[model samples]
Target: MSPSASFSDVVRDRRAVRSFLDKAVPDDVLRAVLDEAQLAPSNSNTQPWIVHIARGTARDRLSEALLRADDEERYSLDFPYDGSAYEGAYARRRQDQAKALLDALGVSRDDEAGRRLAARRNLEFFGAPQVALLCVPGFAGARITADAGMYAQTFLLSLAARGLGGVAQTTIGFYADTVREALGLPDDHKLLFSMSFGYPDKRWTAQTPRTYRASLEESVHFHE
Candidate 1:
C-alpha cells in the first residue's frame, strides 16, 4: 500500500472493516491521513466538518456512555433514522448487507439475543484503538452535510492508502447528545457519524463479508 498506488487500488482495497487489532496507529501517520483528507473540496471552501478523535481513556468513556444509552434505549439523534425509509431496493440491500455480516459472525436472524449483542459492537468501536467522531453544524441543511460526507469519504480513502482500515457507523449518531457531552463539544457541533480505525484484524472473518454493488446501468443515469 504505497502512497504512489493508483486510485483504483485504494478504492478497491477500501471496505468497511468491522474488526481491528489493538495496535495503536502512530501519531504522524494519523496526522498525515487527516492532512490529506483536509484536501477534500467543500461548499464555498467552508470546511464545515469537525472531527474529534478519542483514544485511551477518552475512548473508553465515550464508548461506555454510548453503551449505557443503548442499554437504556435512549437516543438523542440530531437527524432522523427510520427503518421504514428503506423501501423497495433499499430495503433489500439493507437486509442483504446485515445478513452478510451476521452470517459471518455466526448469528442467525432468529437469535434475538445474539443480534442484540452483535448490534452493541458498534458502540464498542469494533475493538479499534481510535474512534473519530465527525460533526457538522446543527442548523446546516443537507447541502452542508453533503460536504461533510465528501470529507468523510476522503478521510476513509486516505486511511486505506496508508494500509489502515475503518468502519463508519451512523449508529453512533443515535446518541448524539451523549457523544457531545462526553466530548465537551458546543451545542452547534452536531454529530454526523463516527468511525473506528486502526490496523485491521485478519483473524476476524466477519471483517471480510461478501458484498456487492449494483451494476452501472442500474445505478447510473446516462444523457446524450
Candidate 2:
C-alpha cells in the first residue's frame, strides 16, 4: 500500500489493547516495524531513540521485577505539564476519562481495591508476550522528547498494521531509576516509556470500544 493509505488505515485501526494472546511475534516482522519507526523525522536528524525489545525469559523477568517494584510503592511520575495548573475543560476531560475507565471495569468510585487491581495490570504488561522499552539520552531536551513521541506513534501504528496491538506506557518512566538498575540500561539513557505488544485476545468484549477523534476543523486552524 502507498504510505498515505497505509498510514491512514493503521491509524484508524489502532487501539490501546489491554489484553493480548499468547502468540509470539516473528523477529523479522518486529525488525520491519522498527525500521518504519526509525523513519520518523527528528530535529537536526538527531534521531534519538534507543529501543529495547524483550521477549521470553527476559520479558518475564522484567515483568516480575516491575510488579515487585509496583507492589512495594507507587513510582513518582515526571510530568511535562503540571496537573495542578490544569483547569476547566482539560481537568473535566481527565476526570471523565477516569470515571469512564472505572465504570468499564465495574469499579465504584470508592473501591480502592478495584483501582489497585487495575493499576497492577499495567505492571503485568496486561499479559502481553513482548515488551519494548524506549529510551533517550538523559540530558536530551524537550525537542528530543517530541522526536521520541513521533517514533512512538510510528511504532504503535506499525504494530497495528501487523494485526498486533500495544499500549504506550509512561508509568514505567516513573520508576526509571529502578528499571535502569534492574535492566542494566546505560547511565546516559533514560527510560521514556515502555510498550506492551502482542496479538489481542479476541474473547474480551471490553476491548471493542471505538475511540472518537476531533473533527479537522476543530483541531486545525489556518491564518489565511
RMSD, one per candidate, in order? 1.4, 2.6
Tens digits of per-residue lDDT, candidate 1, 1-224, equal 33776899999878898888999889999999999989999989999898999999999999999999998988998988898888988899999999998988889999999999999999999999999999998787898899999999999999988889988999999999999888798999989899899998877844556589988888899899
Clashes found in each candidate (C-alpha, N, C closer than 3 A):
0, 0
lDDT tens readout by residue for model 2, 115-215: 98987888778889888888888787789888999999988888888878889887777777666766787877877888998888866535455545557
Please report, as a residue range, the 10-residue window in candidate 1 with the lowest summed lDDT.
202-211
Q: lDDT values of the candidates? A: 0.90, 0.79
Candidate 2, which ten residues in sequence have the lowest lDDT sum? 74-83
The count of backbone overlaps in candidate 2 is 0
Model 1, residue 118: C-alpha shift (Å): 0.6
Q: Candidate 1, 86: how far from true, in Å?
A: 1.6
Pairs that collide, model 2: none
Which number leads on TM-score? 1
